[model samples]
Target: MSFDYDLFVIGGGSGGVRAARISAGYGAKVALAEESRMGGTCVIRGCVPKKLMVFASAAPAEAAQARGFGWEDATAGNFSWDAFKVRLDAELNRLEAAYTKGLEVAGVNIFHQRAHIVGPHEVELADGMRVSAKHILIAAGGRPYLPGIPGDDLGMISDDLFLLDRLPGRVLVVGGGFIACEFSTILNGLGVDTTLVYRGDKVLRGFDNDLRELLTMQLADSGIHVRLKQNPARLDKQGDQTRVTFEDGKVEDFDAVIFATGRAPYTKGLGLENAGVTLAPNGAVAVDEWSQTNIPSIFAVGDVTDRVNLTPVAIREGHAFADTIFGNKPHNLDHGLVASAVYTRPHEVASIGMTEDEAIQRGGVEIYDTRFRPMKSLFAGSDARVMMKLIVDEATRKVLGCQIFGPEAGELIQLVAIPITMGATKEDFDLTVAVHPTLAEELVTMRQPSRRHEAPAPA
Candidate 1:
């Protein structure tokens, strides 16, 4: 079929950009459209800016802890939100330019307008321009979701955090997910009176139970009022304060209420139905392992697919999709054993593979768990302890998973994922020499199993 381009990509996110660039590199005529910024969520409002905030928020605590290292002059003074915001905005602008430059270098036509499917092979841009292609890619990503409730508009979402002109004096963070927990900690460290309210019994619902419990204690110790089993019935603005009425009728007021409840796929207004593309019940675009939609010429990736919604995973999926269809290197991404890290105060949480609950559900398994105060914390007289756990298959002794909650947990997990992905066994880990004077050595030093469980026989 004759078309304007070989490929037309909607949403210049990590996934779409990677797909477009790689496809262009393969000598395919490509064009991409993004109504918003070029870098999408991660670069503009998500991981990039969020991590910078994490670093900024840690300054106070780190400065306070310096006293233990003989630096008597160290003190956490006033933080200027205005100053940080200026630098953050500049960094975002630089990053967006980089994304645009990369796309241009790859020979992909850039359109700074929203694009939606008008037909299986046709997309209409916001400027009333229609473009036809042999294939279409959707990588629109996701956005923070706010629940429908009375006066809910009074509350803010994660995106609002980056746009705040000034930091709130008192903040209420809603949700039990990583976003809620991370922001709660960040705000608390930044000297805001932070309160975290989650309807669930515990936060980080799907993570290892031990890690969740440890984090709960750490958060409370760090001065974040953790309220579990509570949800807001409504939110109302009252004279510069947000009044939150809980489902149980308890009322609390805060300078701001941020909802990190969850994110929904960004598939709206994309005209997927008109193009014969299927969408999941959660509004994510339905696609195969290779990211192909029901309509042969249409495909989706990244948060829009709701499959392992991490930036790196999305980029890999995009690269894989391009290689398979355009580069002539057919392959599919194995979504298993994807590692992730959550940046929280005092420590971080990271994991790869299955959780303890998941391992038990699979079959017989053995678990190794340990908790201790690291040398640095011990010297500082801090009560915070590090946690390390390994979930191993009883039958094969293969390490099915690993979880760590401590300083540099994220860095450790990245290296640990290499062996786990290669199917390393518990014995192999035990045989490895430990790196002394380090927290991660505990991973290799633990020789005894803390517990073992046998799965129930088939019913």
Candidate 2:
């Protein structure tokens, strides 16, 4: 069928950009439309900027650690939000420019306007222009969801936190998810009085219970007021600050209230129905493993499809889709077994494969878990302890899951994911030589299962 391009990608996010670039590389004419920024959520708001803030916010703790290491002159003074924001904005601009350059170099036409499906193979931009394509890819990412409460607009989401002109003296962070935990840590580290309120019993509700409990303690130890089982009923703007009324009928005032409750798929008003596309109950675009929507001519990837919502996963899905459709390589990403990390204060949480609970529920599994204060943190006079857990299948001796909570945990889990994803066994891990004096060595040296559960008998 004759069309405007071989592939028309809506939303210039990491996923969309990758699909567009790869499809163009395969000699398919491509065009991409982005209503906002070219780099999408990761580069512009979510990961890149958040990580930068994580680094910036850690200055105080790092300075204290330096002092503990005998650098008496090291001091953690007041953080200058204005100064950091200037540099941050510049870096984002550079990244946005790079995204634009890459798309241009890849021969993908770029449209700096909103777009939606008007037909199976047609897209209508905000300017009333309609373009048709042989195939369409939707990579429009997710949007941060705010609680449907009074004066919710006055509360800031994660994106708004990054754009703040100045850090508040006292801040109230909402939700039990990683976003709420991480930002509470960031604000506390930046010398703000931070209080975290989550309706759940603990933060990071879906992670391993051991990690969750320890992390909650670690967060409290780091000086964040952890208010569990509590949620803000409403937010009211009181002069320059915000007054939050809790469900318990308690009231508190804060310089700002930030909502990190959760994010929803960014498929709103895309007119998917016009294209006969299907959407999940949660509003995510319904797609197959190959990212193909109900309409054969249309496909969706990234958070829009709500599979694995991580940036790397989205990129993989996008690449897989482009390869399958344009490069004669029919393949799809294995949505399962992808590794993830949460950047929280005092420590990081990383995991791959099943949790202990999942392993217990599935077949049967043995668990090897250890906790100790690492040498580096020990020398720095920090009380934070490191934990490493291995969930193994006793029958096959294969490691079912690995979770690490400590220094360089993110890096450690990345490497651990390699072996776990390769179907490495507990014996295989034990066979490897331990890196002396390293916390990760525990992965190889644990000879005993702290607990074991045999598989349930067949009915």
Candidate 3:
């Protein structure tokens, strides 16, 4: 007997759209529901818009450096915040329309409404319509979390920052995660007096310690007041300015306060409890290796389940889930060997797998690492630098992890991740010929183990 639908996906974010569209292509009847825009967090608020802002903020600095490259006079003039807002609005509208069109082109039924799980095989939409499917996938993504301070109403979350009516002259950024660091860098680069306040010692807490240190230095050098080991206690507004008081009695005044602290699973009103689906204590829909929920017919992916919150990771997980469940090709998502990048000024940080500290804790590990200034920076009189590290298991000789900090770190780490996930060894990198005049070549061309293990002979 044919079922109503092979798959029904909720949340039209990256994961939901990809899974719904791909599964439909495999002859599976698929229906996708999204209460918001199609592009999800990345396109609408998180990554794409944020990166565009970062690019806009860096243009002045780039133009200034272009003078050294032979231009007698290279000056970036005053930029209007309103002009940027207009451009961003037009671009975002186009992106959302494109995502919708893509899904429509894939022959997937798109429903623009809130979806709720009335049962394992049944879903109800906000418009009083219901649909039934063999499998229900939840990919609601995540929303920025605000601190529970006395005056949180006076501040904004990461989402609100993108749709602001006006740019603030002075902004206070709270949190220690990638979001906080990136927004702080972008705001400061755009000539805003940005003060980053974090409860941790550094901005990116779980990233490689070396990269964290280097990024901290770069942010500080760029004029961001890095306030560590501090927590926001309260906020007071006085005629358009917000004064943030820290738990330690430190006070900072700004035109706006941004809480980039963290995000929770976006399952607020999906009625998961009514459907007997298990959720983690933190409110994420619990899932197994195959993205299956406690209820066999229900599944979840992306930030909703509290796994790696990267856009690419979510896209991969969705594809794997669709392949495993509908495409008849069983697949399991391996979290290791996944690469990530932080968009910060002067230096970009990228990494796959464990850090040196983590490798040491695992025991019987060897780390080969290197640091140097980029060649292009030398002629430009720029102090920007690049660093790379390789972590390997001593006994097995299997490459366990890799991390890089510098220009194009994100671009360089992708190549390493493929071989690393394939279980390539340190000797494999040693034998590979270096790509001359490229920053990535430094990853494979290190002369010796900077910290652990022995040097290998060249190929």
**Residue runs of model 3 more than 4 Å from their true location after superposition:** 1-3, 453-459
Model 1 misplacement above 4 A: none
Point out the worst 10-residue segment of candidate 2 by lDDT: 356-365
- lDDT per prediction? 0.92, 0.91, 0.87
Q: Higher lDDT: candidate 1 or 2? A: 1
For model 2, the stretches where C-alpha displacement exceeds 4 angstroms are none
lDDT by residue for model 3 (5-63), tens: 88999999898988888898888888999898888998999888998998898887787
TM-scores of the models, in the order given: 0.98, 0.98, 0.95
The collision pairs in model 2 are none
**lDDT for position 217 in model 3:** 85
Q: Global CA lDDT of candidate 3, please?
A: 0.87
